[model samples]
Target chain A: MRSSVALWAASLLVYLFLYVPLAIVVAYSFNDSRLNAEWVGFTWHWYQVLLHDEDMLQAAANSLLIAFIASTCATVLGTMAGLAMHRYKPKLLPFMVITPVAMPEILLGVSLLLFFIQVLNLTLGMLSVILAHITFCIGFVAIVVKARLAGMDESIFEAARDLGATPWKTFKHVTFPLILPAVVAGFLMSFTLSLDDFVITFFTAGVGVSTLPLQIYSMIKIAVTPEVNAVSTVLMLITLTMIVLAARFAPETLKARS
Target chain B: MATPAFADLLKFRLHKNLTRWLVSGPPFLFLLLFFLAPSLIMVLASFRYPGEFGGLAPLRDANPAVLQGLTLETYRFFFSDVIYAEIFFKSFGMALATTLACLVMAYPLALLIARSPRKHRDLMVLLVILPFASNFLVRVYAWMIILGPQSAFAHAIGSALELFGITPVPLLFSPVAVLIGMIYVHLPFMILPLYTNLEKHDPVLLDAAQDLGANAWRRFWDVTFPLSLPGIFAGSALVFIPVLGMFAIPDILGGTRDMLIGNLIKEQFLGVRDWPFGATLSIMLTLMVLAWAGFSMWLARKWSHSHA
Candidate 1:
């Protein structure tokens, strides 16, 4: 009985440690003062300020645009790659896919920046950011979709083939529907990752472009104000919502606890 | 009639080999170009000489007189630079500390969550993931508020310490502050993997060990600890690699006083505008991470094999 109590107490403290900081951010967002030192009565003025800020809005819009385009492309390509690996079991495919993810983000960012400026001579802007995001996002999407495909019944594809369906017909009729949830989940996961990405975007976004994270970073570098807190709260809510939705559409690993 | 012929033609073209290529080829080519090619470029660029203005020298500007513009000068500079060497060591030390701290804090919580009822288990898992959904910068910023001097918590601590005639230690912009930020951000990464591994553990083994008169401590050491080695390895890797390269946390909370390798790399690129040196540092960091990962995996395998 004593041991159980001790365990419960320790776990609760850990959870609080994890959550208290976030709660503080939400709290400070409403603090009437610019200085986040002491709360001087509650007000929604910061939220109002955030709503009116044009640069913040533009950064948010740019982030959404990048996330949407990059995730869609990653999902399509990743799902196709996942299906191919499932069927063929190529030994090198997993290694190739995992390399981008396993590489440190700073390295990936710097290397891409170098490649764009020196080799490709492409300008650092939204297009380069999207391309860099897709490069890493594909690995995550492929991993998720591959896991989904592995768990699925292989005989269903055989059944479709035996019924005189062509290879494409079999995939179109049988495989696509079964893996659609995983694909959606992968897409949402990619979307959230791209939205939250900082290191790579920071490196690749050379000039005249700023995502929400990049903007927040610059803002924080200058000062930690209530306006920044308000923007952060909004960003946190969007990412959390996307993640929860992604988990809903994801396969067994996410749902397994229940 | 035309549609039927087109359908037949499509069927004719879609052979097994062709289908396989069509599915995998695009993603493979995409990764090769964007992922593999960039890394190769960085590696090649690291060998070249820097220009007078910070970035690499133009091809034509490379004096053909000196071994076709390739020199070990940047690498030589990196090794000879004491500040760079110190920053690399400090970053490695901090990463090791963070990994160790995460392992200690995460183990019990993971076991508790794994042992919880089904409905509560899912909620606990959600709690672990909730913090991760927040922007990384915002989360670090939140830490700044809590640790800053004006916060109530800091004031209370100051008052309590004043009663003992001891000075209130400022927490922000110090190594301690950076450590706290690192552990807070990475705790989830450690917990999830550990929970997954612990959740899969068999309760029967514990019961059987108890029935055989083994104490709880012995049972844990002889049974549970051995089984969770894989989780320990995975969680460590997940926390350590990112923490090693983490610049934002130390930059914001540590007040940019201490420079880690991540900050150094950033300084080289954005601060100093020296692309070649930045590429060199990046390559070095990547190699270190790869080596650490390989070593951890090997250790996990060896331990698991020995125990099995």
Candidate 2:
């Protein structure tokens, strides 16, 4: 009894350690004073400023646009890579895709930056940011989708093929339905990753292209603010909602396994 | 309904081969071009110099496609630069420290989660994964407020410590601040895999060990620790790899004084417009990550094979 109690206390304390900072930030978001220590009164003025701040507003818009486009592209590419790896006769595809997963983001970011700025001579902007995001996001999508594919029973595909179904028909009628959940999950994950990314976006995005993260980073450099907290609380809420929804709809088996 | 579908697949093997290629070819080509090709081009460009406005200029006197011929100047310069060398070492040291700290913090948490009552397991799991659900930047910035001197938590702690005759160590803008940021951001990555593996462990085995006259420490060492090795390796890999190139946490918490490898590469590529040196550093960093991953995988293989 004592040991179990000790374990419960330790776990709860560690979790609180993990979340208390986040709670502190959310609490101070409503503080009337710019200083983070004392709360004179509760107010929504910081969030109101976040809404009204023109640069922030534009950066948010850009972030949404880039995340949508990049996630969509990465989903398609990643699904394709997953499909290819599943179906390919070649012995080399797995090693190729895993390379991106193992490479440090900074290394990938710098290498891509070098390719764009020097060889391609493409100016950095929103376009470059989306491209950079898709480059790595595709790897994540492939890995997740590949895991899903590996678990799916191959006999279903074979059964469909035996029933006089064309390759495309078998895919549509059997394989696609089974993989659709993974595809959707991969899409959502890629979107979240693109939205949250900082270093890659920072390196690839130049003048006139500021994502929410870059904007937050610049503000952080200037000085820490309750405004950042207010914005973060909003972000955290949205993320929590999406994740809960995904978990609700994710396949029963995967949910259990995860 | 009872047809041997496996037999049909075997009979149509040749056609299946062609069909599979047809379906998977597009993504293969896409990765080949955008991912593999760009990396190769970067490698090639590392040997060339920027011409017009520091962009790659067409070679007028050489083969039409060869923009600029190979040169070793970039590698030479990177090796000779004191700042680059210092940043590289500092990044490695910080990453190692952060990994160790994460292990220290996470091991206890993982043990707690693994031993928790069945009713609370899901909630416990959810808490571990929660930090990863949000934006990376916001997560780091959250730490900024928590550690800042005038921040409520910091101020409260500071005042309480003063009353007890202790100096509240200045937490913000120090290496300790960066370490805190890292531990906060990465603690989940360490715990989840450990929990996954630990949750699957057979409690009877440990009980059996105890029933056979093993002590608590002996049971833990002989059974529990060995079983958790896979989780430890997975978690360590997850934490160590990214921390090597971590940019935001150090930048925000450590200030300009605590530049890591990531910041150095960024400065070279963007701030200074020195592409070749950046590429050299990136290559070196990539090699180091690969080396660590290879070593970890080898260790995992050895552990499993011994058990087998």
Candidate 3:
């Protein structure tokens, strides 16, 4: 009994350590003062201020637009790749798919930036950011969908083919529907990843473009204001909502754990 | 009639192969062009000299008359410089510290969660992932506010310490603060894998060990720890590599004093505008990460085999 209580207490402390900082962010978002030193009375002024900040709004919009387009493309391409891996059992496919994820983000960012500017000669902006995001996001989407495909029953495909259905028709009618939840989950996960990405986006952002993270980074460099906290709270809310929705769509993803 | 059916089957097989190619072709080419090609370019550029200003230019710009145009000056400079070596060592030290700290904290929490009821276990896992879904920078910034000297929490702690005649230790802009941030950011990564591994642990084995007269500690040491080695390997990798490459935490919380390899790489590219040197640093970091990953995989495999 004593040991169980000790274990319970330790776990509680760990959870508190994990959550207190986030609580601070949410709590301070409503602080009426500009300085983060001491809380004055509570107010919604920072959220109002956040709404009016044109550059922050634009950065947020740019992030959303990039995430939407990049994740959509990553999903389509990754789904196909995942399907191929499941059906054909390609030899080099896993290595190619997993490397980007395992590689450090800074290296991936710098390498892509070099390739774009020197080799491809593309200017850095939304397009470059989107393309860079898609490269990494594809790996994640492919992994998620591949896990889903691996768990799926293979006999369904055989059954479809045993009927009058052609290969394409079988995939379209049977395989696609069964895996649609996983595909949607992968898309949401990719979207959230692209949205939250900073290190890679920072390197490839070049001169003009700014995501919410870049904007927050610059703001925090100067000072920690309530406005930054407000923006952070909003970003956190959006991220959590998307993840929860993704989990709802694909229960199997949560089951895999690793 | 037999020949026609055989031909039809052959046609169908051909169609299947074509469809497979069509499905997998785009992503394969996409990774090859953007992911694989960029890494290759980084490797090539690392050997070349920097441009007139700072960054690396195209190889075509090199004059044919210059025999030793491509040089190992950047790499030699990296080796000769004491600061570069120190930064690499310090980065590794911090990463090691963070991994150990995460493990110490994560093991108990994971065991507790694993032992919990089913619904509670799921909820705990969800809680762990929720913070990760939030913006990474924002979460780090939250640390800044909490640890700031002027904040209420900090002030309260300081005053409480003052009552005991102990001076408050400044946390912001210190290595201690950087470690805190690193551990906080990475704790979830450690916990998730450990929880996953621990959740699958069989209670029957523990009961049998107890029935065989083994104490709680012995049961955990003999059975639980061995079973969870894979999680330890995975969680260590997940925590270590990212912490080694992390710049944002040290940049925001540690201020200018705590410089690591990640910051050095960032400075070379963004701050100093030396792309070749930056690429060299990136290549070096990549090699270290790959080596660590390979070593861990081998260790895990060997351990599992021995135990089996």
Candidate 4:
């Protein structure tokens, strides 16, 4: 009984530790004070400031554009990778798909930076950022789709094949319908990932391009205004909504991620 | 008639091969081009020389006698300066510390979540992941406010330290703040794997131990700890490896002396434009991460064997 009490108390503390900072960030967004030091009277001035901030607005536009293109490409290719891994169980494909996701983000960032400058001589910009996002996002989408595929009944595919359906026909009629939710979830996951990505984007984004994360990073480094809090709060809401929607689409995406 | 049947079989075989390629081809080529090729370039980059201006020295040269700028200069430089090695050691130590801190905090939370009713487990886990899914820099910035000199918590901590006769250290730009940020960012990684592993453990075993007169502590130390080895390692690796490569935390929260391997590598590439040195440092970091993983797996196996 004593041990159990200790466990509950300790666990609650941990949970509080996880949440208190985020809650503080959200709470301060509405604080009227310019400083983040203490709570003041409530106001929407900071968010209004955010609306008028040209740099922040431009960064947001760039982030969404990059995420949209990258996640779409990642979804299509990742679905194919997932389907292939589930069906054929290819030996090398899984390794190649997952390693980029598993390795430290900086490794991928550095390697791609080297490749961009040295090999392709490609200028670092939005295109480079989109390309980098796609490479990492593909693995995340593939994992989700693969997990969804694994949870399914394999005999259904076999029965369709036995009933004289071509592989393409079976995939069109049955497989696509079953995995659509997961594919959607995968897309959303990748979208959030691409939007939230920083380190990789930091390396690949040349002086001309600025994503929301990059902008936020600069803001945090330079100052601690309530405008940073306002932006963080907005980003948090978008991520929260995306995750909740993704969870509703394919619940297992959350579980399989661990 | 026989010839037509044979032709039909051949057509079917060709169609199946086409289907196989169509299903797997795009992702295969894409990963090969984008992922595999870039990683290979980095490996080659480590062997090249830094260009005079900051990027790689040109690989091709008109004069063949110039050695083409390929040499062991970066690796030699890394060795000649003990500072680089000390940074690596310091980073490793920080990673290790962060992982241990996460494990200690995560264990109780994971255990509680695992023991909860099944319907509540998902919500509990979601709660853990929500803050994590929020912007990473935002999470670090949150700490900047909490640990800033003007904040109440910082004042409290400063006064508390002064009461102990120690100088009131600056809270935001210190190693302590960096560790706090690391722990805050990485605690979920430790919890999730542990929860997944702990949830799988059979409850009957615990009951069996209780019936056999093993107290709760003994049951946990011997049975639970040994059985949860895989989860511990999983959580540890997830925490330790990322923390090892982390630059942003230290960059935002650390002082002058807190330069880890990550900061060093970042400086090499971005600050100094030394691409080869950056690649070399990355390769060394990779090797170290792999070594840590391998050593843990070996230790886990040894631990389980002894218990058995």
Candidate 5:
């Protein structure tokens, strides 16, 4: 009885440690004081500043567009990779798909930065950033989809083929419906990752382009204001909504990433 | 025509081969172009010279006055300049420290969650995941607020130290603040893997240990801890390696004296505009990570073999 009580207390403390800092950030967003040191009368002014700030607005638009496109492409390619891995069991495909996901983000960021300038001679902007996001995001989507595929009975796919359904027809009728949740889950995850990404975007996004993370990073580095706190609160809510919606589709996405 | 059945079989085989390529080829091609080619470019970039102004020098048909063509100058510089290696050592120590802190903090929570009722387990895990799901920067930013001089938490720690006749140290931008940020950002990565491993453990073993008169501490140390080696490895890899290359936490929270491998690499690319040096530092970091990963896997294998 005592040990269980001790375990419960320890776990609760850990949970509080995880959450208290974030709760404080959210609370200070409403504090009207520019100093942001103590409790003050609640005001919506910081959020208002975030909404009207021209730079923040532009960065948000760029982040949304890049995330939408990158996640879409990554989903298609990553789904194909996942399907191929489960069905074909290609040796090289798994290595290529998983390594980029596991390595440090900065390595990929700088390597791509070099590749763009040196080999492709392509100018860094929205296109380069989206392409970079898609490259890493593919690995994540593939892992989730592949995990979903791994659990199912192989005979079902074989059964579809035995019924004389064409390859495309079998996938369309049998496989697609079963894995649709995972696919949607992968899309949402890719969207979140791309949106939250900073290091890769930092390196590949030339002077002309910016994203929300880049903007927020600059804000915190340059000055500390309740406005950063407000922007952070808003970003947290949007992410929470995305993850909850993703959980509804496939709870396994969270597990797979972890 | 030959036999109709034979002809049909040949066509079906051909179609299977086509489908296989069609299914696998696009993603394979995409990764090859984007990931593999870029990594190779980085390897090549490390061997090249910095241009007169910045970036990589022209490889072919270069002006004699400008730095051009591939050379080993960056590697030589890295060898001669002792500071580069010092930074690498500091980053490794920091990674090790962060990994250890996360392991200690996460184990208790993971144990509780694993022992919890099955239905409630997912929700508990979700609670842990929810905070981390936000931008990691914002998560790091939270530390900045709590550790700032005016915050009650920092003041409390500072005042407590003064009672012992020690000076009240400034908290923000110190190594301690960076370490806290590192532990905060990475604790979940440790918890999830350990929980997954512990959840699969049979309650039978603990019962058997208790039957043999082993107490709780002995039972855990002798049985449960040994069994969870693979989980420890996975969790450690997730936490340790990323910490090795993290810059933002240090950049935002670190004082003037604190610099890690990630900051050094970032400076070369973005601040210094020295592409070759940046690529060299990246390659070195990758090699070190690979070596460490390889060593840990070997150790885990030995532990498992002995336990088995």
Candidate 6:
């Protein structure tokens, strides 16, 4: 009993340590004052500002667009890769497929940037960002989907095939249904990763194509403002909600506790 | 019902080589061109030097005009540079330290959550993981706001400490800030893995130890800790590798003054336009990660084999 109490208290303090700063940011987002700390009154001034901030809005739109395209592409590619890796006996090759993930972002960012500019002669923009994102996102999707595949009953696929189903039909009818939850989970994870990407996007972004993270970073360089705090708060809440939903609804294979 | 019909269609298609190739060809080709080919290009380009006009023109010593014969000049340059060497060593050291700190911090939290009565564990785990779901940069930025000079918490805490005759500590843009941000960002990575492992542990083992007259410390050391090593390894790898590659936290929290190897690589490619050198560094970094990953993979295989 005593140990449990100590544990709970220590954990609670950790929670406060983790969340207090964020709470302050969220609290100040509604502050009527421009200053980050000072709270003159409770008003949605920054929220209102965000409503009309064209640059921020456009950056947000670009971010969503990039994440959507990139994450979707990554999900499809990753699902296929995962399916092949899990079903086939080519274990060593899949490691190479996922190696891009372990390579440092700067390394990847610079190499991809170099490849694009010097070799491919392509300008950076949504296409470059999406490509960069897919590079990393594919690995994430593959890992998650692969883990899910590992947990699935291998006999099910074999059983489907034994009954006279073709490989494609077996995957579509039997394999695909079992893996759907993991695929969704992987997609969400990829989307969030793409949405939150900065260093890679920063190195690869062209002059005019700004992401939300880049915008937030540049804003920080100028000065920390309540509007950013508001945006950060909103972003945090959305992500938190999604993660909780994922954690709760995730299949046994995808659950962290497993 | 539908399963048999689908299976029949799948078996019918499997008889045709064209359909099999069609099913497998695109993903294989995609990975081959985009992933495998690009990495090969990076490796090849790392060995070549840029020529006049700042372009990747070829060196004259090779059979193919564009391909240069192997040169270790890039590697030599990176190794010979004292600043870069220091940055590389320091980044690894910091990553290791951060990993240890997160493990120490995470152990108690995970134990607490795992030990909690059935009703409370889920809530506690949910709260613990909530912050990790936020944008990684925003969370670090939140730290910046809290630790920065203008922080109300900083001022208040400093004043309160002064009342007790203790000097206020300066925290922002220091290594301390980097450690704080890293631990905060990665604590969940550590906690969840440990919790998963610890949850697998049978309480009966502890009871058996007690029955054998082992003290709690001895039991944990002899039984629990050994069982938990895999989690520790997993958690540490998750935290350390990413932290070594981290550019943002050190950039924002440490104010870009304390440059790590990641920053050095970024500077070369983006700032200084030294593509060959950056590629060399990237190759080195990739090699090191692979080496570490290989070691861990071996360790895991050995452990599992022994257990089996």
Candidate 5: tens digits of C-alpha lDDT, residues A12-106: 89999999999999999999899758897899999999988999999999999999999999999999999999999999999999988899889
When 1 and 4 are scored with lDDT, the better candidate is 4
What's the lDDT for all of these models? 0.86, 0.78, 0.88, 0.90, 0.92, 0.78
For candidate 6, give the DockQ.
0.49
lDDT against true structure, model 6: 0.78
Lowest lDDT 10-mer window, candidate 5 chain B? Answer: B60-69
lDDT of 1 by residue, B169-255 (tens): 887888989999999989988899999999999899998998999998898899988899899998999899989898888899896
**What would the per-residue lDDT of candidate 6 be over residues B64-107, giving only the tens digit for each residue?**
65646567778888878787778888888888899999888888
Q: Best candidate, TM-score-wise? A: 5
Please state the error at residue A77 of candidate 4 in Å.
0.7
Taking the tens digit of each residue's C-alpha lDDT, what string does model 3 give over A1-258?
123877788888999998889988988899888778776889999999999999999999999999999999999988888888888889777677778887778888989998998899999888899989998888777877888888878888889989979887998899889889999998998899999999999989898799999999999998667999999999999998998999999976564324
Candidate order (lDDT): 5, 4, 3, 1, 6, 2
Q: List candidate 5 stretches off by more than 4 Å.
A: A1-3, B1-3
Number of backbone clashes in candidate 6: 8
Question: Cα lDDT for residue B236, model 2?
Answer: 86
Indicate which candidate wins on lDDT: 5
Q: Which ten residues in a row have the lowest lDDT in candidate 6 chain A?
A: A249-258
Clash number for every model?
Answer: 0, 0, 0, 1, 0, 8
TM-score, candidate 4, is 0.97
Candidate with more favorable, higher DockQ: 2 or 6 = 2
Model 2, range A83-188, lDDT digits (tens) per residue? 8887663566666666665667777677667667756788989888988888878877777777788888888888887898988898788888888887887777
The digit string of per-residue lDDT tens for model 4 on A129-158 reads: 999999999898898889888889989999
Model 4 chain B: lowest-lDDT 10 consecutive positions = B63-72
Q: How would you encode candidate 5's per-residue C-alpha lDDT over B183-261 as one tens digit per residue?
A: 9999999999999999999999999999999999999899889888799999999999889999899999999778999
- True-contact fraction per candidate equals 0.73, 0.61, 0.72, 0.69, 0.70, 0.42
DockQ of 1: 0.61
| TM-scores of all predicted structures | 0.94, 0.90, 0.96, 0.97, 0.98, 0.89
Docking class of 6: medium
